[model samples]
Target: MIRVAIDAMGGDLGPRIAFQATQKILAAFADVEVRFYFDPQHFTVPEGASSNRFTSVSCSEHVASTESVDRALFKRCDATIFRALTDLAGEQVDVVVTFGNTAAMVALTRYIVGLLRPKLYPALIREMRPAPLKCLVDLGANVHCPADMLTGFALLGSAYLEARSDDAANVALLNVGVETSKGSSVIKDCYQMLSARSWPAFSGFAEGFELFDGGKNVIVCDGMVGNAVLKASEGLFAFLLSQLSQHSMDTTAVEKLVRAENRHGACLVGVKGNLVKGHGRSDEKAMVGAIEYGIDIARTNLSKKIEQKLIQQGVL
Candidate 1:
């Protein structure tokens, strides 16, 4: 059975959404088990969440979305996210899913679970739409990455896609212009480093407009830029949908498509264990989607595959 550990109190909606999601997942998948970590003093699990496959652990503290990583590490060691990562490190669960502070989660994961490649840091990768196979790496995990870490993101993103499919991933650096000389010095250095690699298909720099063109399987960038791109895309989607409604166009089909596209959560790649981070404002449906994403990653043995790839490529 696949075991999933959840930080029930991580998101903005509190533990209610997590409990509801757990109930839905338990009802749908018979072979899955879930362990929820939350503060019993602040919230209570729903009656319907009781199942042999379900377990609850009490955690008195939780890191807020605005909490700094250092403060969380030193002050709130008993937070739900920390406890969940501890369980994951101890082999109590196959994977961890949280919608808490991204910075805190990244820090705590490195502190508790450690990295697969000691020299490399973890990056958040998420599949994008219009081209479902396309993915963007470093979605707000590391705000400032040097050239080496940027190349590492490429490796992590490529290996992640390769694990899910038979084809070799086509990687690209996200930049303002497609021209090789266009980005900052750091990006140019990353481009040079990636160009030296012979395994994965390294397409040259990709402009933001090329994201949905289905040309590159993986787009690499620093966390700050990637996070901005993601938020802009989401905002644009919402604005366009609203405009379509104002025009008296039927938006039902578009809404369905958006929902389907938004199902998968971001994966914190390069870590020793699987950790999926959902949006902080996730509702029950999105929370369930994140858990399902974690289950899929767990089943794929993604971390093991990444390790093998790193060894074969001599990345470490």
Candidate 2:
């Protein structure tokens, strides 16, 4: 059975969404076991959580979203997040899903369970455009990455897709324009480096317009630009929806594509185990999606696949 450790004390609503989602997940997935770490004073165990598959561990303390990463690791060492990570490190859990402070989660995962292949953390973001679905790496993990760092992100992203696809995924570097002369020297050098690789079917440079066009399955960019693009797209979508709301249009389709709850979570690529960071303000539906996403990662053995590919490429 797949075991998942959840930080029930994380996120804006603390343990409420986590508990609600846990109830749904437990009902839907019979083979999965869940360990919830929460502050006992704040959270009450639900009747549905009494099953053998569910385990609740009450934590004395919790970490706030605004807490500094260093403080969260040291001062709040006994926080629910740390308790969940400790369980994961001890091999008591197969995966961890949390809607906690992103920076703290990243820091703790690197310091505790360890990084497997690419030492740098890459934010794994998915594009749901039905025409052509794709994955984007380094959405907001590393703001200022060098050429080598971008190369590492590419490897991590390709390895992730490799876990799901029998055929090689077409990888591309995101640029302002399709021309190699359009980007900075770092991007140009990264282009040269990726073009020299044999595996991953490295396609040439891709533009912003091509992101939703479904032309490339994997797009690599520094966290700064990628995050900006992601937020911009979200904001643009919201603005358009607000403007068009007066027209009484069926907006569910468009909202589903760019909503925070729809994306739900981002995987911390390069980690040794499955670790998904759910949105801090996620509702029950989003948390459920995050947990299921972690389950998908565990079932696919994404970490092991990435490690093997990295070893084969002499990258580990």
> Which digits, one per residue and each the tens of the lDDT, describe model 2 over residues 1-316?
8899999877787788789899899999988999989898888887656678899998888877888666437556678888888888888998899887777777788777888844455565554342344677776767778898888888888777766565467888998788767888998998899888886678878988777775587889987787778778767877899977878888888776555334557778787777888877888888998899888878776778778877787777
Per model, state how many residue pairs clash.
0, 0
lDDT of 1: 0.86
What would the TM-scores of all predictions be? 0.95, 0.89
Clashing pairs in 1: none
What TM-score does prediction 1 earn?
A: 0.95
* Predicted structure with the largest lDDT when compared to the true one: 1
Clashing pairs in 2: none
The lowest-lDDT stretch of 10 consecutive residues in candidate 2 is 124-133
Best by TM-score: 1
What tens-digit string does per-residue lDDT give for candidate 1 at 183-205? 89999999999898896789989
Clashes of 2: 0
**lDDT of every predicted structure (CA atoms):** 0.86, 0.79
